[model samples]
Target: MQPFWNFPATAGGTINSINNAGIETFRGNELDSLTREICQNSLDAVKDEEQPVIVEFKQFQISRNQFPQRDELVNAFNKCESTWKSKNTKIEQFVEQAKYILKNDQIPFLRISDFNTKGLEGARTGELGTPWSSLVREAGSSNKGDSSGGSFGIGKSAPFANSKLRTLFYSSYDITDYQSHIGVANIMSFEERPGFNTLGTGYFTDSHNSTAISNLLNLDPSFQRDETGTDIYVTAFEPKENWVEAIRNSVIYNFFITIWQDKLVVKIEDETISHENIGTLISKLDDDKEEYCQVKAYFKLLTSEEGIQVPYPAKRYKKIGEFKEGEATLYIMKGEDLNRRVLMTRKAGMRLFEQNRISGSISFTGILIIHGTHMNQVFKKMENPAHTEWEPNRYEEAPSEAKKAFSDLRKFIRETVQQQFQAETTETMDAFGVSDFLPDTTQVAGEGDEKKESLTMKIKSIAHKKKEKPKKKVKKKQQKENFEDTLEEVGITPEGDQAGHSNDDRNEGEGLGGGTGNQQGEQGPADEGTGGAKEGKGEKEKNKPIDVDTRYICLEKDSGLYRLNIKPEKKFEKGKLEFKVSGEQSDYILPVITVTSNDIEITSIDKNVVRFVNLTGKKPKNIQVQVDYEQYCVLEVDLYEI
Candidate 1:
């Protein structure tokens, strides 16, 4: 039997009166709800499982009546003369379809047992969570989860601000008891009842491994839950044009605070990343508050090959005030233990990779001053519950209080991140080793000495006393003859008593008493025969001066080596080196050079009035001159050879 097609009544009509029946407004609050849910699952999995959490995204195309074409849409717009007559069928239908997808499709899709596996539930021993809890299971508070960042309860609706489509999330969790899976399904649409936006829970699923589960795998094998971990799935991940990085960064930033403290291993794909430690972000109580508050600036060394001798003092507290020009209020804290803590900073500036001032997360920790404290806030919105958290009123107000907090926190964090990023970039360009990029951490002077002193005191207290008194010596004529024979064999003069001699000969005619002593008669007081003074003088000569300069430039200086060529048409008297150029600048001429006592005495300078000055004041005895014409102009003076 064949089916017959039914035609619409207005199929042949102009249809000039179709009205726009969908919603027109969008709010970010809804997206926040969705973000909270996603973050909650990630934090839970990380805290409960291992590293490399996997998130899965699934998209289901909505089924709806085919909408009108572009020409029809344009005709409809052109025919309308006023607001009362104007029709917006395209946008209106899209909104309606979006709403329908959320309610009918997405909500139902996530509830399937195959999608929401039992691995997580079983592993957790039914210690699962709903939408409102923190991941930490403390004594007083619940171990389930918390809604701090996802506080507003509107996070589920957050996605609507980005798209009007079916959104689904699937996650797999690894636990000791058993691995588990959780799925979240939602539809974003306009509710006709109140003419407002809403999110509907479309579906949920949970189960143990089975054929049904294998069919739902959407992630790479690396992301598959082989061990204890979690996977997040979002089907139809409709990302805005420029929001990909923002959303990813937001997720990562929030993830650190929520789960980083729990010692969970984290990764985006294969690359391992961690949060800056809390202890490294704060200053010590004994530290100079003024210096701690001062903005610290330095280029961070990058690359595994280059090494930097970092001299920055470590801090132990978070500083919140700007103590210098062009620097923001920098905060430092030790997020974790000494080894785990990282120093982080936010900066603002442009670079080749970044079009504008690029901002994100940078690791800065592991310093001495931050020996205490364990709450580090480096990335934007990652810390500060007032900012990262969403509030209900935030959606309705233009400059919402929560949003203002976010902005402020964002500014603070951006600077820190920028600074770190620049440091990394600089290190990369300079090809410095990773070791030298360490933050300047303050050290406790004499800490080692104190420990050593304590140990010495302990040893002295445990040691035994010395023996009583020494025995008297007996001299023999045969012993003297043997000593003389030994000296003669070794080619030394028997010395009229110099070899195997008596106390008189040892004293060498000095007077032990008021009167001079002879070779006999007890040798006066025995002190005159000894040559102790001469031996002391000989020992002093062993430490005589040797020609050596302690100052020398090695690979470290060469690591950041850069040459700037300056040429002067005419030589000038002693003054600061300055020059001007004009027209098609082609060739570079070596500049006339001058040096004062303050300037490091260079080992060598170019003869054409060009000389290299070492600002470090390290005088060298030799120098090597070089010119790189291809670099446009660069006058290099080798200080090592000098």
Candidate 2:
């Protein structure tokens, strides 16, 4: 049968207008929304298991005559305008603009075509769960796989939002050789004739059942979905000036993992984002924003051959919520200018959100790739409509499990961050003193002899003018060494604030690769096919002293000596180095027998503090610290200003 525009009669039902909350959900972000949603849906519709699905976005202008039934749509717009001319401003304004856009002799269309996937099937039986019906005949509904990137089904509205005329055309040729096509217009309620009103939602199909056209509808010459896939034609496309770059960034931002894993490839205009060019694309995103930087970091983690794999049944926590089941890999790297948040992403490779539950005061970036069937099934339920955040309450199946899972995820993130970097600078100063962690110089015998040449010299250095930014507060109770608040009061701020900076130069991605060679394999063995044990809420978390980036610590064999090699990031004047020894279940100050430095001029050696002068940034300064204990145990050192 021939096709025509169909807006079913309301038949004295509740009147509707142009205020579509689903369409409005993507306001001001039409292009980004479209890119994210369209790509996510394609990822879910994967047909071949071994190959990647490809999505191509091509926009071109065609003469208005090329689009069939153009006059009929224009007539509908006229009726819509006349019916709500002065009755509703929003409807009136929308109709006026849509009518104006329709009057152009040359109409613009953005034809998005996808390949290497099953097309919109199930149209033959007109079934409810078919791809054709789910995408065309239905709204706010979906039947994707367990690990699909999308869940809310609201993503379908984003395409309409990109169209100035609020119209969209969907056509597909399924793997079964079945073909079907349909068009939908979301305008306002209007009167087709006297005393007869039609629905605001209109479809280009048979009036009786809204069945799609069985034959393929060629809307544009530049597009032809000859393969088993779907094509979305966004009419009256009003793309932004930087729409190309924006779309490129959005594709990478949302599906970097899929692209990097050879599961998805996106072609925009002349640029292709696949496993081959994925690295280069990620590099270009270095200057975009924090979110983009996160994308760059995530891409680096996914491509890198190293990271920690935390497997199912996370059984470490006692008080904190623990994961009873899941599959995930975590990669954390400490460096300059890292935003210090965990990138939580699903198997679909789309980033659900950046987690900042409790990062503590350590500068690092973490990526948690939650994959596998059981994990994705649980995690996807908590995802919001936009696939941006994890909303535990959104889980209708089991709210409690989802909430606990979310909490456990945060705990795991926080604990891993704390374990990787000694986030706790020192013990609570209220209960301890600096002298408690340091040895008494009067009790040592060599103190009287080294005092002859010790002369206190005042060090001169450049005074910084910028105000220091305070570190974030995190409450954690892991027992360890008691270094007190010395570093907290006089710690080095070598390079001013690092926020709003670039990390592309750090090459921080080196040690972050997972499932390969690493010096940290000896930490603790983990479940098969996963990373090792991370210390948190245990002994590993204790004795975590702040590590000075420019300093290195080592203990000599058959000697009571701990050598500290210091090379400041920026120049420093005069400072004191504190050395402490490991205590059973707790840490106390190791009594210093003697303090000596090769290049530094020692002003005085009091207890554990080695006050020195002229510690230049020109070269490394070697300081040999002598203690009474000969046996080697875990040791920690910190640098403080005099």
Clashes of each: 120, 9
Q: What is the C-alpha lDDT profile of model 1 across 293-342, one tens digit per residue?
A: 22111111111122122223232222321222222333333221111122
**If scored against the real structure, what TM-score would every candidate get?**
0.28, 0.65
lDDT of 1: 0.28
lDDT of 1 at 577: 18
**Residue 181, candidate 2: how far off, in angstroms?**
0.8
- Which lDDT values do the candidates have, in the order given? 0.28, 0.69
Please provide, for model 2 over 149-185, each residue's C-alpha lDDT reduced to its tens digit, 9 standing for 90 to 100. 8766789999999998889988888889998888898
